[model samples]
Target: MKEGNDDEIWELRLYVAGQTPKSVQAFANLKKICEEYLAGKYRIEVVDLLDNPQLAQGDQILAVPTLVRKLPPPLKKIIGDLSNTERVLVGLDVRRV
Candidate 1:
């Protein structure tokens, strides 16, 4: 699932507060998307806001389940349970063939 010959890596951060239903769903959805689209070219870091609330400020997280694309420049964010694959792909600027 590498985008091109550049060998670029997709750095994603999932911010959640404890193991709520939404948080769990978001993580599951994200993993599915990455496995299908990103494969080995992606890295997911799950950050529990409940454990470290101060980290939220750096990312400006305002919700329970927020997906942050930290690498590849022009950082992007998608906030939700991430049940919509098409929307998630669009939000991450990923075009499926």
Candidate 2:
């Protein structure tokens, strides 16, 4: 099962406000990371908090532009504008230490 875990697909949810500069940059950075590393093995669900603020509670989101890693166990949360791609990637367990 150890081998299976490494190859498992990733599920990521990015919470953001609509059309904000930070949100746009976050998406761009996330997209690049997914393509460069996770590739087709990941899914990013961008949530607009402006529309549904309630969704934040499920993940205990305290801030906008938070990225939550929901799958593959040991769920992790990263808060910010996703200004740091490498940091976010590592925090999400998409890249090893």
Name the top lDDT candidate.
1
lDDT of 2 by residue, 24-65 (tens): 888888888877777667889999999999998889888878
lDDT at residue 35 of model 1 (Cα atoms): 91
lDDT per residue as tens, model 1, 1-97: 4354347799999999999999999999999999998888899999999999999999999998999999867799999999999899888877644
User: Which candidate leads the pack in TM-score?
Assistant: 1
Cα displacement (Å) at residue 3, model 1:
4.7
Error of 1 at 14 (Å): 0.2
| Candidate 1 lDDT | 0.90
Clash pairs, model 2 backbone: none
